[model samples]
Target: MAVALSTLVEEANRYLNCAAISDYCPNGLQVEGRPQVLRIVSGVTASQALLDAAVEVNADLILVHHGYFWKGEDPCITGMKQRRLKTLLKHDISLLAYHLPLDLHPDVGNNVQLAKQLDITVEGPLDPSNAKVVGLVGSLAEPVTARDFSRRVQEALGREPLLIEGSAMIRRVGWCTGGGQGYIDQAVLAGVDLYLSGEASEQTFHSARENDISFIAAGHHATERFGVQALGDYLARRFALEHLFIDCPNPI
Candidate 1:
């Protein structure tokens, strides 16, 4: 049996528990498509490559971490923006996106999934006040050297991670899966031995040295792929719809 696009989106919103807050873009059903959805495609970003892959698979719905209609973007649809939307609309493929909700979900979130893959048991959120915070505080099953942890991240994600080791061995760790170098301070204050994130800025090295916290920059796209894949699998099982996760290699 095929699932309705509206039904799948409603189920996702409830399962992710995303109805509480105001988001930059609409969380579900950004573009209308066929009434009955049989195949679903998931990806990190709704780029042209992803869209093309979804089209190739004849996906009725496309779910992504990054979607259209960001806060600071121009409302006028033209150029690349028009092209993306035009492709989805022309192909009758619905677009469903979950941003912060997907990032913070305890089970299927990027941080939690990354931690699980690394054999880290999540203790709690790094920031208690902000429920939307993507970083998580967790402890390793056993203490491991910072160098070993760095290599493990590289091996798990299939990308060499940039590591800035501190004096301490890593057991307690904090991680945010994508572009989350800013959360290092929170991790340091939380008394974690290491801070892991997808991307690092020029100042992250200085922050790591001064703050005495080990830092690791695993590839942004590599670290973030797990959560959406988990979510897609859950959705597929729940609704019995066909789901595929398409990975687009991103260096940064």
Candidate 2:
């Protein structure tokens, strides 16, 4: 069965509540192709490798958490951006992207999906005052040391995380996936004993040492891999479309 690309985008926007949230990039149908879609390829980013994979699979639509045209990005379609767009246009594949909306979705969100994998019992948003807080504060099933927590993250994400130890034991935890090292301060203020994020900034080590909070810099791609896949699977099931999740591995 085939579905119109516009209908799929509408369903996704509604499912993810895309319109309500503000993001740096446009959240739906960044690049339009065929109106009718039968096969979809989903991934974390619409990089060249992923686009090639989608083309190989004969995908009619490609969905991703990260897509082209960011807020401050170079508007001119030259160099890398040019090549990426050329591939999509050449292949006639529609590109559907969701940024903050994918990360903030409660059930299929990056934070909640990671929490489920790590056995974290969520309590509330890390930034409680903000209605659209992307980061979350939660508790582990039981208190574990910084080392043990890092191990848990490694086991869950299939990649060993860079660790900054804080205490002998940790209970309360806070996390945000994909380049949210800045949110560590908010988590610190939220009183989480341990904080996890997709990537770590240079200041993150000092922040952990000073704040007495543990930190784990799980690879950005590793941490964010689940959300887009989850969203894709849900859509595939709902729409009866054949979907494949392509993982273009990134060590970062």
Candidate 3:
């Protein structure tokens, strides 16, 4: 069944509370295509590959975590941006994107979703003072060695995580998925023995080793795939529309 494009956007805004969270890019309806959406495709990023997959699936709307028109980006569309925009325009497929809003949602947010998958008991935000905390600190079900913890992350996400040894035991863990390795320091201050993020920086390894906190660099695309998929599944069940998740895997 086809649902009005406006209705989908409205629900997304309400569900994500997009207005409350400040984002680099617009949170809803980045591109307009069809009046009604019969089939929707969701992905981690709205890259050329994901868009091409959406076209292959004959998607009317593409839901994503990352969208175009970010702050500090080139104002004019040139080579890559031009190609992506042209494909969406030529194919008449809508694009719906949510950035921080998707990451900060309590129930379906990336942080919470990852904690659930990793079997960590939620404690609270890594930084409580920050109104919109995108990262969370929690305790594992049982205390495990740093090696054991890394193995769990590898198994759960279906990817080998780059591990940095911190301590012998890891009971408490903090995480912010998708290029959030920068938050390892904050997670350290929060007293978590382990810090998990999608990407790792040179400084990240040093910080983890020096601060006595275990670090896990789980792929950015892998850590972030859940939120968009969860949102798509939710919208699908709520409105009785067809929803498909197109995985355009990225090692980074």
The estimated TM-scores of all candidates read: 0.97, 0.97, 0.97
lDDT of 2 by residue, 50-164 (tens): 9999999899999999997899878998999999999999989999999999888899988889999999998989998986568998987788899999998999988899999
- The candidate with the higher lDDT, 1 or 3, is 3
* Displacement of the residue 199 alpha carbon in candidate 2, Å: 0.9
lDDT pick, better of 2 and 3: 2
Ordered from best to worst lDDT, the candidate numbers read 2, 3, 1
Candidate 3 Cα outliers beyond 4 Å, as residue runs: none
Model 2 whole-model lDDT (C-alpha atoms): 0.92
Give the per-residue lDDT of model 3 (tens digit) for 1-252. 799999989998999998887878899999999899989999999999999999998999999998999999888989999999999999999999999998988877888888888899999998898765579999987899999888889888998999998855999989999988888878978988889999999899789888878899999999998888889999998889999998888999
lDDT of each: 0.90, 0.92, 0.90
RMSD (Å) per prediction: 1.1, 1.0, 1.0
Top lDDT: which candidate number?
A: 2
